[model samples]
Target: MFTPPPSPFPSKSSELSELEMTHDTPTHANPSAFPTHSCQSKQKYTLALRWTIILVPITLIAIGVSTRLFIHPTSFDALSPNSIHEWKTWSKSLTDWSLHERHKPTENSPWLAIVPGTNASPVIKRSTLSATPAPTVPINPTLPTPFPQPYDTTLSPNFSTTSCYNFFLNMTQTDALRSCRPFSLLLTRSQAFIQNQDDINATNIDIWGTCNTDLSSSQCDLNMAWFTSSLRSSCATDLSNQNAMAVSALIGLQAFDLMRQAACSVDPVANAYCYVEAVASSDASSYYFYQLPLGQALPQITSGACNSCTKSLMSMYSAALSSANATSLTGLQATYGDAATKLNNVCGSPYAQTSTVASSSAPPSVDLTSVGGTWAVLLAVGVLSTSMSS
Candidate 1:
């Protein structure tokens, strides 16, 4: 399979020897036939020199190839143009990695300009792209809220003490955490009562004065001008007994009412359930007034332009009124009307029954008979016309 190239020149030593042998062999008769020994030797020497020059280059090339294989036997096949380019790129990137720790190239890095072979001078210059920055994930806090947990009460005290858990515990004690059992929330309930007592004791005089105007003087009982004073005197313990859970439950009910009104006004009765869960789940306090599906829990209502909702329609409505720049009476009436309409629609038929017309309304039996007779007469007329046509 291997063939060696012919030498370009003959050996000078052999050529000289041949010339000497020829010279001694004959004195040729013809001058043309006679050969000069010196001349032949010189010609032979020149040819030999030429062959040596050519063969030396070939030998050197073969030695170089053999040395390369000996050094890197496995990578010999990868010596092609394409593979060499790839290896160069890889080596460059790897070298860059050590050089610049922060600016290391990634797999997602875009292709840059391409270098072409000698035959083509300039290759297409692609857009140079930097590596994507490391992702920065948000760290969520471990706090808990009325967001439903499993109904399991056997959780560790540490879990209950978490912010989220504490918030839910606070809610559950008030019936706001429907997922939690009432018995498990005794501590939170007690603490809520203590807090309420403090709030009650610190009631503002202005607020108390306002209550007096709405509440009857006779109803005040203890000669206190305001309902707050009456409660401080007689109903103090009663309200304190309510705990935070009851108050939360009351707020939840109000939120549910408001949501129901909003949903009904926007959608048909059939689609109302979608908004019911949505609006109910909008706030944790709202959870107390309604039950969630097995896996569903209420979400938190973030503070914003909207008023912070809690127990007591008067206060909740007042807050909403203040936030939106609406008068107190206007806000209360609007909210109440919406709640009443939704309640009426859900609990009763579409027709409103006025008390004045109760006795004057016709019985159902009479209407049914009348409608039946009308249909029978129409049927007889159709039969008679068909018989005449036949």
Candidate 2:
């Protein structure tokens, strides 16, 4: 009787076959319910393939760019030839004019205070009202004594004697002496300018009336006093004391080199001759006033002496000259050459001659590190976006 009821249904074998078919075929009408293993694997592979297609090249490019940028960098000396030429031309013109004017003054002129072969120091009388009695202060016997007058006007009144003394106390003798060089130079140069009142007036043409002339002069004197006292007391290493005049000469040369740079920066075209004239005047004042006087104070400041100092000074000048871009190397060459010659005559030459001009034809260095890095990042982002979308 049960078999009879099952007669309406399929046979056992057919029923089994039907069940097998049903298991094999899709269950849902959409055909999505029974996904094949092969199909799923293929879909995953396609997604991976798409991402690989997008990201592989991006990764490669990023790596390539990063490598390039890390190698090369730009520097100030890498200016274009044309720019260098313009700078040299302008600087040379101004320098020429200045040199010509400088020579025009007669030996008897009051402005020409420092005679070439004589004592270079200017005869200055200390104001009785402001002069303090030399203090019987205890000083390091290892250091120089009877410190020179203030030269640098940039320092606090107590800087040389108090601040410098305190600061230099912790340093080695060599370091302390080296530190004093800049201050000594500034002081000597400033004093030289002050002594040459005519040179100061001429050089300060632009700033004289408008730039608070009276205050500047007073301040300058005050600063010089500070430097003079500091070098005498605080920076008074034995070596410095022995070679005080030599140190003064070396620093003076450095000041002259600095003045050349300042002069070069004066736009001859835009400012006409005024700016250049001012620069020249200022430079002359500094040289003849402070530097000459300081050098004259010691025996070592003369020519054929201070050989080490001359080398150091030449090195600094060479570095500065090498940094400028100009068509003609003549001006720079002449400037440093003249300086070297003067030093040789005054002190002596142990220093090698330096090339004053930069090569115009030198290939400009390209800094691609920045550009390459940027491209690498952009490509990486594209790869990431593709991966996410996939």
Candidate 3:
């Protein structure tokens, strides 16, 4: 060890004790007395925390603002409850119709059954519906007495030109008859009828729920009554004397009438008739032939096979043939005679059945496989359809 000259300093133990006290105990006024990396580290951490506090809310606000500006209302509305429910309803209706299952398979009410006790034809009451009687429609001076027959079913000529058909159109569309609903729907629906008479399966005038109680209360009752009455009149059915519009008019009017009669059920839904279906195909076909074209074409109409309520229906329609025989209107007779034979061969016959389709018992419930943890694909379908139809 090197020898040192000692004078001002105390012994090593006393000097070490004072030095330790100085380093261990810090003073506020002498804060910088000892240089410290620990203080620097704490300062850096505080700065980082302050910046995090300031930036976090700002980052969240920016994201929210960006989403509001960028996203569309319709894109967001796909998630709405109304859009989801409405889309499902229409989809279910279409599926049920196409599958030949007209009625929901609700357990059939026993009284509604047209079985052995009811046997269909005898128990039903006569239709309360009747058309207002009108005289023969005459040609106006604006046109020739015998106008040329136009072949197109779709012509809605100017009112002045349609002298013969104008009277009926007036009953439905004139401002005086606003209750008939504007646009003269009968005029348009008649055109539609001529196009798809075969595809039509129901005579439901109650589509809007406005006319369910009785046809007379319907907004278009006067028009409907007149349209039905005019076509069945002996004069309107005469092929020898009328124009082509008359031909088209009668075709559509009779279609509307037939459906009106079918839909004017004493019961709810078309299913009371649809319940004519059976577990076996052969027996099912046997029950309802009286209403089909072939059955109607027969010189003497007859149906006893199932003797179901459709038999009663065929009986009510049979009254039309009696009028037809008196009027000598064979065409109208055929149209009226087949009211029991359902559209799409749904009731109890194979006349309208085709190979491409197989019957289903009921429509399927709305369902979809979850994908990527999302709701049913119908949400996407509803979204797409909303984009187009809404």
Candidate 4:
């Protein structure tokens, strides 16, 4: 049987060598060729796929970054606040602003203004709004009186679009850049974490009775606590891992301080409404937020008439200046005074005067770390309860 196979046919070992030769000399080179794997087709495709997915995007980014700078406070086109581009744009802006000595907050500042051992009482009284205005209206001797015009009852213009997004959009350069801008800018960087829209509108912060606190007392402090505490379960829980909050993080005691200092108070309830109205008005008119610095931005927002909203607007800086004088919170008076002076020209005097004390210190940084139920921790540092940040 074994001898029969040796006739006219090669042995198994010989066949193996022929097959090896076939592999060595591919089909292109040898006429009598079997299927040649080359074991390279898959590899080439894999490499090409990798480059397309990885290199193409990287190359595009590299080219995009070629002529542009990374950290300078360069001017950028104004984008819609609720858009992803807007979120990242401001986030980059915040990173840029965070670098400046003038723009930074006090190191490790206790952003909260509430007294220890205090419990929160509800400030969201929808029926009424007032800040306990002074008996005599002497903010401007020239202007008839502080409340010269009747209270704009139907204040804070409404918008069809809604979200807790642009809470600080209307924030003046003094307010926004001072305490909340850094956090607001964080929205810009947050898109990486959320491929979808993570933005909330500035006016969306216009929740009814949310800011109904009297800066004159611990009412504002407790209200802030309540707000942050509420965020703990909702937005904060969802975004806690990021250690930041959403972009519109102006929901701290700092807001209360602003109302106290700048806002013309009719009563505690009305005071909150005043602050809201002013913010809503400012946010409504995107007139001032076009990549402009304080020099430009200040006048843009305050350019409106000398209404109660504008009155508080002027007081924000001047009141801060007075507080800085008393508290010796250095490096603040100059900044606050400059804004106040400019606002004085726009609005008037006595509004920024110490007589209407907005606060006793520079507005601390509003952390905006979370919202809903996760806000307490962030509010502890001056932020959203869980504006579950970007």
Best by lDDT: 2
Ranking by TM-score: 4, 3, 2, 1
Q: Which candidate gets the maximum TM-score versus the true structure?
A: 4
Q: State the lDDT of candidate 1 residue by residue for 214-314, as single tens digits.
A: 33423322221232232233323333554332322222222332322222221133322222222223222232212211101112222211221222222
Clashes by residue pair, model 3? 120-309, 121-312, 149-244, 203-259
Off by over 4 Å in 2: 1-112, 115-301, 304-307, 325-333, 342-349, 357-390
- Candidate 4 lDDT, tens digit per residue, 301-343? 3455455544544444445445543233222331344344444
TM-score of each model, paired residue for residue:
0.15, 0.20, 0.28, 0.29
Comparison by TM-score, 3 against 4, better one: 4
Ranked by TM-score, the better of candidates 1 and 3 is 3
The true-versus-predicted C-alpha distance at residue 38 of model 2, in Å, is: 99
TM-score of 3: 0.28
Model 2, span 11-92: residue lDDT tens: 9999899899976755456765556898878887788777778777666554433432332112211122222357765454
Candidate order (lDDT): 2, 3, 4, 1
Give the lDDT of residue 293 in candidate 1: 11
lDDT of 3 by residue, 260-351 (tens): 34323332232432222211122323323322211122112233244444444455445544453324333334433233333323435642
Residue 236, model 2: Cα distance from true site in angstroms: 48
Query: What CA RMSD would candidate 4 show?
Result: 19.5
